[model samples]
Target: MGAPPQPRAPSRRVKLFSAWFWLYLVASLTVFWFAVVIPWLVITPFDRRRRFSHWYAYTWANHLHAVSPFWTIVVEHAERMRADQAYVLVCNHQSSGDILTMFSLRKQFRWVAKRGLFALPFLGWMMAMAGYVGIKRGDKRSRERMMAKCRRQLELGNTIAMFPEGTRSTTRHMRPFKRGAFVLACESNKPVLPVIMVGTHETLPRDSWVFTLERKIYPVLRVLEPIEPAAHDHDPERLADAVCERMTAAIEQLRAEIEARGGLEVRPPQ
Candidate 1:
């Protein structure tokens, strides 16, 4: 028999076109910020900014996803979402695109992000409007301040999304989960919801902005059931490890399932 037909990858021209799409979207969002979002921020009441910003970001991100032929996002377990209750969302860090998935959840949650992201011109402004908490790495006071802000947000019945590993992982192996998210969850007495996002790394991997479509890329957002606070309320450090173990196991199971179904093609080595 003749050789089978190979999958048609995105042509360079298509990639280039998608690049322009991103640029145009960013530019448009900028105009959007200055013309609409910014004006409302300045004039709107403080309490109202949170809701408005979440709405704006969700709409903008959805538009971005729609225009970009680069990604096919499949959001699962959406029915499990309880908008009425607050949660501490924990997810693996793979690529910057993970940020969009966070906004995709369409919840008014404050993200615990590195202070560096707060420096990207329009992106930083959008983040600020979204009520994200910025943490200065290696600074104790910064960590405390971030935790304090997180606690307050949780108390207010607002969700908080955190990549407990602190930085993006370049491979399939997840970075060691940090204690911040677990500690905060314990202190705030909130449930921890584990999230698994596959295929983001393939979209825009570390040190490479040039989008690659070696294979059709479709990222999935799967939310595992919540992990309620431990009954003993042990030391924060110990509780953190327990939380990490749970997340690690969840990731492994998801990875295996994805591989078994042949849904994910790229499993970058640790």
Candidate 2:
């Protein structure tokens, strides 16, 4: 099997277009900002779950993909979802672009992000409005509150989404899984839904934004079969490790498939 493809350098034209895209993105976001806020504020009073916030945020975030025609996201196995069944979703954190890529799932789940990110001027406040959960690293008390809140959300029949690695990875190398998400799965008796994401960092590299058309950059999100609550026998550590192992292997397989098609490159858009 081939190793995961490395990031490719962008041509001069792509770089210039990226600069312009960013400009257009910022303006669009600014223009649409109020549309989300007004509805969120009105609905927060009646909808304790802020379910509308999730949909609004999902819609708003997905616009990031409208920048270029060549930039497309491929979603797989989405049919596995069933209406009204809440779940605990765990996915690998590859790049910041995931903030946008994830919305493509079109599934309603409260996101668990770092508390620091929730403090970013407008972005953080928007997250707050979306009712996403945030955790403070190494702050035991903060973690406790986060876990409590997540448990409550689960009890309310709302799905919870988290990156068990705790933070983003610049490459395909994932960090150790954190136990919080798995613990929730066990305690809440909710099945764990593992998702495999590939090619996100290459599309929007952590250290840089440059990308080349030398190969097609297909950001794929694959939702795997759910792991029943009994699969881990109520053991959080076992659940975490089991999910991690399967996800790691699945990601490797996905990358190998992509590599087989010739270096993540596709013919330039016509």
* Best candidate (score: lDDT): 2
- Over 4 Å off in model 1, which ranges? 1-11, 14-18, 46-49, 231-234, 264-270
User: Each candidate: what lDDT?
Assistant: 0.74, 0.79
User: For model 1, how does the per-residue alpha-carbon lDDT over 1-270 read when each residue is reduced to its tens digit?
Assistant: 222122355578767875787688779778767865655657457664376676777888887888775566777776555888788888888877788866666656778888998898887888887788899999999999999988888877788989988888866767888888888888788888878887776666655555666555567777777777775373567766666777678766766676776755533222
Candidate 2 versus the native: TM-score?
Answer: 0.89
lDDT of 2: 0.79
Candidate 2, poorest ten consecutive residues by summed lDDT: 261-270
Best by TM-score: 2
For model 1 the local lDDT of residue 206 reads 53
Query: Candidate 2, which segments miss by more than 4 Å at Cα?
Result: 1-5, 211-216, 262-270
